[model samples]
Target chain A: MSFALNGRPGVSEATRERILRIAKEMNWRPHSAARALGGARADAVGLVVARPVETIGVEPFFGQLLAGLQAELSAKSIALHLMVVEDTAAEIEVYRRWVSEHRVDAFVVVDLQVKDPRIAVLEELQVPSLILGGPGRHGGLTSVWADDRKAMLSVVEYLAALGHRRIAHLAGMPAFHHTARRMRALRDHAKRLELIDAVSIPTDYSDAQGAAATRTLLARSPRPTAIIYDSDVMAVAGLAVAAEMGVSVPDELSIVSFEDSVLTRIVHPPITALVRDTFALARQAARSVLAAIEDPGSARDLETATPILTVRGSTSPPPGDAIHETV
Target chain B: MSFALNGRPGVSEATRERILRIAKEMNWRPHSAARALGGARADAVGLVVARPVETIGVEPFFGQLLAGLQAELSAKSIALHLMVVEDTAAEIEVYRRWVSEHRVDAFVVVDLQVKDPRIAVLEELQVPSLILGGPGRHGGLTSVWADDRKAMLSVVEYLAALGHRRIAHLAGMPAFHHTARRMRALRDHAKRLELIDAVSIPTDYSDAQGAAATRTLLARSPRPTAIIYDSDVMAVAGLAVAAEMGVSVPDELSIVSFEDSVLTRIVHPPITALVRDTFALARQAARSVLAAIEDPGSARDLETATPILTVRGSTSPPPGDAIHETV
Candidate 1:
């Protein structure tokens, strides 16, 4: 009749048995056990998002991904702890505390940079983590990434088919490992196509930065006829700048962007860009993280999201007048 | 020399003293001792967003608020754990687990509904939480909200000033606390202005839902000349529906929306909508949550944001040919 079991004092056996039986019957075993297990020793998943919140609003990709992760975690009742750090160093400190204190069962690492310090720390601590956006330098950790290289190639091929010879890129930070991969893919695509003077200007993925970068590229001696941006916000900004400068899009210049946010579709001349289902990416990352938590060996699995091109109004063949003028 | 402490069988006093001295110099205190001395806990501040991820993408408000929260939390080395719950009941469960297990120090609650169940749970647990868009039901918990009533009134007055009498509103769920407050305010404003036939349709805040509602209103014997929506996405959907029906914007109908996201500016003939600096709202929420965590008494302090109207190309006077042609 007593609630005590295995020398642990609590409620009556009937109540405890009823609760345990109900939990098992309802498939609430993982979360209930996790909650009963207590902290620094419980089974909760953690996510360390290193990007600032301001950046997240401007960039639609992460918001979608986070949503996907939330959807996956909520169903399993496995808690997803999100920490927003100022920089990579702070992220490392967060991971260190979470791992050493045994506060989290696994980690979801995002925005991996070239020569990331987190890789070493994660490896040394032997903590399980799923990296979203792979750091090509790391071979040991499990990674879930969008195929940026293939996406970039697709973008180039699509633009070339439209006869855009002078294409410029407004890329994200050069220091980012994925940025480097994307840039390499872009250059190779342009080279193979025998295009002259394929240019890339690196910006920090802000609309203003994108606009400013676009302005710089436009001011060149032989102005680029087409511009590509890493994010839709940047592309939107570039569009605004082009509008303000009296440049008619798809007539004087064409524009393409990534992310395919609401902005892309709503803009006057909808941007032709590569689109990835952010929710799918998030779900993938969340599932991968859960799998890693369930079996640490799952950390060896690599998942890549293929980007699809959505053609809208912003792209067209070079203007006949402009082509004749250039000739 | 060992690293032992007072009466503890560990390391020597000399080694311990050196560690303590270095810690003191660096202002780095042990978490356990710091907890006793009222130092910052490593626990994160969690946000349980009750809305779905698909909804988050279309709504710009949450993104801005999260960014603001992130900015504030990052400065204090506190993390923000975000979980998306399917419904209010699920949200309560998430909160319970987070509080009982000390997963987070506090929470920021969003999308408050009338007679919300979370209020009772929060009260029972006495957990520190700040609700965005307050229900006006919970007096004890801290609430940070925009002046929805005033915002609704302002939009009504703005449309009224443009000489539009029949105005329809595409609103969020009627059960939502903000929706009730906004509806009441809109109705009161209409009565005060002596405007006839002001109507409102409650929806789930989705583009498809908004479009369907807009279609119903447009089919009325006397269609509304000015339509105001609770969200930009809804407004965008309404615009699309109008376009499909060959209704010219600002010529036959004027549309105004809430929450000026990038969608507002990018759409053709930019939407004239209610604008608030989401960044500021986010910053304030983050700051308020941290303050509440530090001093639970601060929960009584209510911070309200004022909504500003951004006039774009969507609003104008009623067409001159309508009444005459109908007659």
Candidate 2:
């Protein structure tokens, strides 16, 4: 019976088939928790988010990623255990608890930070874990990352081509590795291109912060001809800020968002944005994590497609007088 | 030892304390899976959403509600089992699987439909379930609801008071009970207030649909002076549509969103919105569902505060000559 039910080598094919048919007739299904007690797969993955809950509502990136994860995982009947924590400490504690309880088969970790403590703890646990952001620094864990540096460079090149000499970037949470990479990308390229007055402003990725930073930047003597936001919501808020201060978008100011979503397209002068398929990125992460769970310590780091800059109404050559543009 | 570990009446207080101390020293905590085999609580709640994966990203309401639910549930160390499914059938399958496996202690159901099938399935399964939207039609299950009808009435009353006679409501999916309630509310009052050209346009709650509907409406010889959207994203899309057609907001048109989020507030002309404490509402639902899990069949229907209409820059008396107005 054990052999038949467990589909082990001891069971003959005919007998196993007969037993499975009988079990089906008896309405028998393997209990997920019972299987976990017997050291079987939990058939679930955990995601512990460390962002403030309020930010989750407005940020399209997280939602799209979650949808992609769900779409892929649910196809295999794998449950997603989601928890939003206040900070990294709380997030790590969740990982510890879930690990000790054997509540999840694997974890999908996001929001990778500089010198992230969660990476060390996750490594120590020796559980199948995948980091959603990184080409490096996630020791022995499978990681999937998009090229943040390359994506930023494309944005800068596009803006420079549009004759935007003075540019500003609204970066998210300076402590994040991606944020640092983006800032550094802007700095390096800005120098190489001889773009004067290029500046990066760190923000919490909140609309309030985005608006405040935009207001401060717009008030400067030689304000940026183009402003790049790290997220779509911030770009919208920056557009609002431009309107509030009587700065017409694309005409007086060009705007670009690092991320793209319906929020970018639905605005008055639809924002020019760097478009990556976040859903596909998350789906790849889900597949990588599932592979890690299936073959622990074997899965390798995966790099996804670089975000492509899609130009729309909100970006154009800087106004004729501001930077002397040809096109 | 079992009594002490389980915290049952058979164990003496001193013995239980000593056992717990030793267990703590030994790093012995209850295994969540092991506990489930003994019919102990799963220490988790399930929320299976039945929306297309695409919509989840841009919708602020779901994220905020999730944040609120997490904030309340996690304080007591309960986990949220989240799943996004294609439709109600998939949602029901998830419920069945989770219930059979004892994967969750209770279920928090959202997006209540008129004559919902899940209500019956939940009751039949005898699981502790709470509907997040409903005052009626939920069969013997606990529910938490805000007054949708009252909220709609207030928006219409406010618009009437502002001297807007031509009102068009861009409603959400028509199958939703709340959507029906909102449509009916507008219908009932539009007659009483003698607001001619009042119409309700049902949509799938996508920004694309919102933009299309707005374009169609704006093309009319006598375009609506006021437009109310069921969601903040849709409202933002509508505002963009007005901009494309060169209709000045709150001058040629007034716009209001039934649900307010950062999206509504950060736009060029900040949208007037119906503000409800969605976070608080979700917290209350979490509490109610937890109570239902603790004492099955003991939880009752809970009515939360009605949404209040918040007037911002988006709403005003309809364009001067379009409708006669005072103040």
Candidate 3:
């Protein structure tokens, strides 16, 4: 049967035709389990996300990224086995179970943590896994990552050039490795630029937190002339907060989104953003993971192009004598 | 092995303990395929979506809905086999393949069409499938749906009462049964209330289309005093269009989003929306599909609660003399 199916030399053409006809008549297809038993590809990839369920819906990043992933993965008829877990512990448990059960050919690890336990777990499982974030601390695993430090530094330089000396960063969860990288970039650059006030406030990447942080920042005695948000949803929420508080965007206060999406482009005064094509990034990640699965240990750490600053309607020169703020 | 692992009456406690310890030491687990061969559950559900990949990412509905589905399905360790296909044909192909391969125990079909082909395919396959949107035309499959017509009628009633007679609807794809339902409900209710110039314009539900539609509508002579959007992303985009065109929301033109998310709430002059908890709806769908999987024909059609009107800062009576537009 294998010879016939593979068109091997031993199988006669007549026998092959008969076998194929019978298989068509019986609607026979290779079961994923049978394939697994034969040590063939499972034709599935596992993506276990650890985030609050509520946050997953409103955030556009995952939705767009999944689109790119699904587009690439579906062309090969490989299903994406997605599971949203509560935390990293549950995430690791999922990886372990899937590995032991031979449920998937590969895993796409996302939301890289500062001290990720899943790295050790995946290494022990000896599964072909691709990390979605990071150039380091991934423990010999292949990674596809955008340079967060470089992107953040470019955003700061752009803002500083616009005469924004006092800037506040609305960052995502502090535990994420990319988040740490972004914060460090901002802290180091702010000191180098000799800024009067530079601060980083970490949030859970929720619009509610974004709004609350924006309100607090704007209410300060000499409010920061600019604010940078980690996500597009947060940037839009912050813009709404600015609108409600009567602070004119790009006039009194400039805003920049670290991530870009339709949310950033559609809002009033259209947010300035560090634009990295997330869809393309996810497609590249998908291709890399597929490669890793096909030839284990062949996928290497890939550093994607840094996000370029696209200055939209949201950023401009700061208010009052801030022209002197430019170094 | 089964008797000892199950701790059956014939198996001694010591024997069962030894069996379990040995199994643990050997790092053995029940293979999903082995279970399938034994006619047990596949422990997975299939959700094949047919939509443009670009739309999937920007749209918040699927993201939120998937979050809900994952939360419920994860508790039982049932993986969601998600596949995004190009169209209905590809979607049906995936269903057939997944069914024949025994990859999923059940299917959760969404985006019900005016003439849904997948319904018949699932029924013929004798698979336990649940439709996500439908109170009708489902052909014996269990469904979990909110009242789209009733929800639309209520939205129209609310808007008409606010003196918006010249109302326009920015609808989603006309091929969708729910889209047709909502459009019909708006048309029927408009005539019943004796309103003037009520119309619906179908769109692909992108922010680009939403903005374009808004611009085209706003530029018309005696343009609509109110516009109802099918999605929150579109509503926000429409709001930005109004701002760009110098049309004040709820002053000259009121806006309402049929679906709501943080996008609606976080925007400037927060949009009024028909609030249905999509997360809750998805959980219900997950439960319904799981039950359908457990007892092949037991799951029944369930109509969830109709979305309630949540009027925020975006709705108001029409401007000036148009107050008399109220019936």
Candidate 4:
């Protein structure tokens, strides 16, 4: 058993194969509790989602990422144990319990917040983990990420080219690491292009919130001629708000959404969107976590492909008169 | 500790509170495994999703259902342990492991298939469970469900009243019990109305498949004046297909989707849909499973409220010439 499990290469191929077959027939899988206690592989990974339960369903991001993570984990016979918590404090409790009990071999962390404290806990526990966002301030924890700054910069540049001088970004959750990253990029790029009246509104990633933000932004004095949304669901809702308000898209106002979904394409004047495969990025993150588990010292931060802008009917040159008086 | 855990009625309220508070302060939690071995409680419920891994993310049904499930479970301080598997065989294995390991107190099962083998497995194991779909073919498992037939009948009646004689239903996977129910209802209802042309097409619930189905159905001679989709995603995709084909919705054709989503209300000619509170149904199921876990013999099957149809821009009187000719 040791020779087979540890790959000592001492037994003949036929003998090793026969032993493995017998073990399978006998249902002799390693018990996770004992394995965890011995500081050995539990053959399981933990992903704790810290978000309000009611809102978790509508966002496509987590579901897509889970599917991507499963693609790699299942092939290696690793079980993904999922837990949902309402906030950061509860999420921290989950990590502590899992670490103490050796319930999981490693952790796959996501939804990074400002000055994430999970890093310190993970470091103290000597647990193997992979963060799913940013090439930013992680405390030596291996991470796989996409370049959110570059992605945000591309969106701003595209809108600017379309003659959108005054723009408003309706973003989700300002405290999140990626949201902050995108906001910073938008500010920097818009300044570089000499565009004035660039603004952002934080939302809770709901259609209702997005619609409300669109209505409030449009009703303001010197209202922006162009708008960008952080999510497909929000973008779809924002478009509905515009339609209900009788604002003509592209002719009077231009729109862009950050995520590409089927929701984006079905709306009137299909939304111009930033397209990137969440599944692919998640797969890379899973692979990196697996690598770190086996050789913790060798793991390093890796960045996946940046988002690419897909031009569609929703974005065009801003309205001739609307772009001026404000800036 | 024993008195508080078991509710034995032998301890003072103040003493119990103090014990619980100290337990919390010390970061102590019951050992779920030991509790399970004593046939007490694991304080967790298992949800095993057996869907194709690649397609799990795009569908909003599972996500919404999960959110609804969490709302009830979290209130009772029960952990929702989620596992995603690829097939029934693997799902059965999960049930066995969870039952034997005492990892969960009960299960919440969805996506009921014909002659579901899961029923027999759950029966054999004597596991407490709640089926989220039909009150049908369960070997003695409690179930919570809504009337899909009544929902479909309402949709057909509404469209028929709108002067759409020839209609088509673009349904999802035929193996799912609810899909079969909806299909049967469509056939029966349409036959009673004596609609000249009625057809049902099966799809895999992907946007691409939805578009393909729409294209094929529309290319026929004297193509149907109206169509119903099994999901919000499919309906949205179908609408996009109609747009691309330059077919004017509500005039040249009408569309109705079975599930209500932000997708339905945000499209160009917003899709008319059958609306229901999935979150409520899921809550009932969660509560049912919890009750069954406490006292299995007392659990009973429950049927929730039927869907309410929401009229929108997509459904109206069909083209002047086509409606009468089909009749």
Candidate 5:
């Protein structure tokens, strides 16, 4: 039998009370109630990609991460509010609008640089955020990042064992926290291996830049026998450059790269690379972001990713006596 | 100036009357009144990717398209909601919830199958939608599609001009609309050119599937001198298979592929490919979806894309005396 309450037919007092109580508990309003109230903001999650669109599309990392986040959110029936900002300043503005307008429940931060300003902005606004990269060197927010230093060392050691003495690294922007760590690790590992010279070239993490950096490295008086690129796209560019210059891969110029994107596997000679389980990383990041949004106190926790090196055909012994040229 | 309407706050009676009249005329709530009634259902755009997360990450097309959409949406202060579903049924369910719950303003539909069920679902609900591929043989939906038939024919003619008579196609699933169109075009164009023995091998659009398809084609009685693939990743896999089989590219077998992804240019013996401006496609889809939401009547308009052929080093004439054997 249906009961009546609040001057409405077929509505029960107990049911109405329960509904109101749950709405208050969740800080949510019924769609009809919201419509009655008029122009009310909705509960959503905000994702700010702190990179240009052109750059983001060419990189495989963001695509996987976004896919994972979408998978989790779809199950919960939660909405993801995505924004692509050109720089950190623009990112700050987007987040401010989202928070002030009550447009989102949480934020997903990516590509964190050292002394990241977003962390400070998020803290001031008390906005729950989960960072895809580390909490930066200073550290104060929830973060999920792959072990770049260890991953770099693994590749370095692998190349060194292949009898390479002079190795050059084509790294991402110098300001990136992970880039600094990766560079340091490469240098330290090279020293430990008794390599004569270990040089680093900074790049903007694009294929064009990667190719240019590789060209400079190759033009050195005595070229490095092996090169390690910060990204798979760059590695692919390096491969192309090597081919263009008539340098035979794994013979005249061995190459190792990071990211392990599809490009690495598709090249005529598959590149030897460090493959981070980006799918796993994305899943972990999604889980962490959800946790941070649910329990703000958990925002201090950091998740670290371990990278595995997948060897293909890109690396081999240096040509003739060039292995020890720098030494 | 302060204005009073509906027996609340007033400075000028005429101004209040005008404001109320305008609100009624537009069938909308006043901005100030709406702002006061906060926390309602938000306006957002939803993107449903009907593909596995594991595979989506490796594909370059999604990444570029997503970035382009994000770029455009961010300018309009609109949020992009992303969801990844395993199949068509799951994608439809996600859309249903979003529509019934008013979680999104419109949807970006991707990877449409031959007789996509999602189209019917969207139509039944009268939800605004923009398809990323051809609207299929059963039209009645807005779609942004690249001319796959023209693209395929161009590849064939380009290879044929290079004196490649024994051409083969490594295509996507037989059931896919684009794949079917490309396959039909390959057969018809081959027939027109008197290359009666041309072959088309269907694949699942993955590297492994591509490799297997290529192997099967190569084992034919009179192997094809030039192979064309539906995707760049599959093309890469074909290259690997060719290498494993000790076939020299361009000398023994020429290759052409679709999607001028980064891998196309980076691989050794770079692949000649058809390049679709993914950025432009994504932007167009975003615009169409937004337009559909604003004006549902225009949702059935068809948007066509032309694929451009970029020649690299992957094509060459059939090996000496091999053409006669195939004919």
Candidate 6:
């Protein structure tokens, strides 16, 4: 049992591999209680999503991320125990339980809110976890993330170059760490292209809100010529709203989504999107947590990939107002 | 422990409720070993998805079902442990692990293939499980399902009424139990309509495959006047392909997707889709598994809802072919 449970010097590497294969084939796993008594190492990772269960279907980002994360973990023979909690409090409670009971070796944390409450909870338990966002405030945990600021700058740069002097960013929930960071970057970049009017619209990342925001933006006397959405769902929604209002895409307006997935490509006049490998990032997050579990010293925070802006049918020279909007 | 576990008469109902709440809030789940020794009631549910993990982003159906299932499970404080396996053998292996270790009280199963191997595995283990499709070839497992055959018939009937005689069903992988059922029904309904050309094209539930299928169907000398896709992604892809092929939607071709979600509604010329409440169906599946867990005798297979067709911009009288092929 000891030979199988831990990678130790006593067992030959080949023998250990054989033992693991046989054990796996026989469906042998250390019982939770027995493993607890045997001391730590649940041989699994846990992720408790604090978002409401309703959000899972509306957002492909979560599904894509988990697919990548799960693939990496499963390849390492690491089981992912996922839980859906209603809010942060429920999430913290699950965290405390998993930590106290040693139900998981480490955790893959996501949905980073500003001054996230779960951070302190995980810190108190001293469990090794890897956050899937930038290290905000303080850190007991390492992280893997894309350069959101750079990505935001590029989106603004692309729109500005397309003669879009008045651009609006349909931002995700205003309070998230990444959302705030991206919004700041948008403002900073917009300022660099002076006389450019970039208004940030705070949104809850829903299709309804996205459509409502679309109506609000387009109804303005001097409506923004281009709009960048924080999600594909919102972008797709905005596109539908544009069509409903008789606004010809790229002729009357331009639509760009922050994340590229199936939705972006499947839409008519495929959206110009900032494409990132969410799957690879998820895999990296999984690997980071495992590394933290096995050898804490070797684990380091990572910035996985640089998101690239792809111009599909969404961007064009701003409709008749690019030069006129300049101060 | 017995009072809380068994809900025996010794404990007051209020006290039982309070005890359960506290235990859950405390994340103080009874250890699986202790539960095994005590006999029955693991207080958790398992769902093992047997598909390539990469497909999660491309498919919205999985996320929608999980969201609904998770909500129902979370309400009862029943932990949901999800696993992803590549094939039947891996899925069976997961079942064995969960069964032997009492890791889950019951399971929610999806993706029922023809002559499914999981049924044999589940029957041998006698673990309480609820399949997520119609009760087709009869197995020990109970299921909660929407009326898929009726849904298919209605799609063909609507298209026929729209003056589309050369209609094709863009079928999901034909090996799936539901796909075969829907295809058979589509053929039967079309024959009743006396259409000269009514065919089913198999697809792998990916946008690329959907587009390729669409191209192949359209390139034929006498192309399908209308097409019904297996998924929203496929329908959306078919719509894009139609645009690229210079065939106007609902004019040169009418399009319908079998499963409806945000994707169907968001696209330009919004797809005429058979809208089933997948979320509610999933909740029913979750409840079915839970009921089976609490009392095996009380659980029975259920037929839940009938899917309804919603006509949108994508379906209309076929352009020139509308008059030619009618009986």
Give the CA lDDT, 0 to 100, for residue B141 in model 4: 90
Please report, as a residue range, the 10-residue window in candidate 3 chain A with the lowest summed lDDT: A22-31
What TM value does chain B of candidate 4 have? 0.88
TM-score of chain B of 1: 0.84
- The fraction of reference interface contacts (C-alpha pairs within 8 A across chains A and B) present in each candidate is 0.41, 0.59, 0.68, 0.38, 0.65, 0.51
Give one digit per residue, the lDDT tens place, for model 6 in A86-159: 88899888888776656678888887877887777787777788888884543757788777888999888887
Best by lDDT: 3
What tens-digit string does per-residue lDDT give for candidate 3 at A214-278?
A: 99999997789999999988899999999989999989999999999888887778999999988
Per-residue alpha-carbon lDDT of candidate 2 for residues A1-327, written as tens digits (9 for 90 to 100): 243245454445655565445334333433333444455777789988988877776688888888889888988888889888888888889999888767799999898887888888988888889898877878788999998999999999988887888999999987898998999999988877769867899999988899999999999987889999999989999999999899998899999999999888887788999999999998999889878887896768899999999999999988888786322
Where does candidate 3 clash, by residue pair?
A: none
Which 10-residue span in candidate 6 chain B carries the lowest summed lDDT?
B22-31
lDDT of 6 by residue, B1-327 (tens): 534345454445654455445334333434455556466465568888888899976688888887898888877766677777788888888889877767678888888887887887887787788988866643868888777788888888878787788888889888898999898897777678878788888888989999999999989988888999999999999999999999888878999989899999999888899988888998888888888887766546799878899999998888765657556
Which digits, one per residue and each the tens of the lDDT, describe model 4 over residues B78-114? 6666677888999899889878766678999988986
Better candidate number, 4 or 5, judged by TM-score: 4
Model 5 root-mean-square deviation: 6.5
Where does candidate 1 stray beyond 4 Å?
A: A1-41, A216-222, A322-327, B1-42, B215-222, B240-246, B322-327
Off by over 4 Å in 6: A1-37, A297-299, B1-34
TM-score of each candidate?
0.84, 0.88, 0.89, 0.87, 0.85, 0.89
Clashing residue pairs, candidate 1? B2-B11, B2-B12, B3-B11, B3-B12, B4-B11, B4-B12, B68-B282, B68-B283
For B1-327, candidate 5 gives per-residue lDDT tens digits of 122233553324654454344334323322322322342334568887777766777778888888888777777877787777778888888888777656677788877778777878888877678878874653566778877888888888888877777888888887778888899998888767768567888877889899998898888867888899888889988887998888899899998888788877777788899988898888888888778766778866565567899888888888888755544
For each candidate, the alpha-carbon lDDT, in order, equals 0.74, 0.84, 0.86, 0.80, 0.76, 0.80
What is every candidate's C-alpha DockQ against the true complex, given to 2 decimals? Answer: 0.25, 0.36, 0.38, 0.24, 0.42, 0.31
Candidates, ranked, lDDT? 3, 2, 6, 4, 5, 1
True contacts kept of 6: 0.51
Model 2 over residues B1-327: C-alpha lDDT tens digits?
244245554445655565444334333333334444455787789999999887887688888888889888888888889888888999999999898777899899999998799998999888899898877978789999998999999998888888888899999988999999999989988878879767999999998899999999999978889999999888999999899899999888999999988878888788999998888899899899878977896968889999988989998888777776322
Q: Evaluated with DockQ, which candidate comes out highest?
A: 5
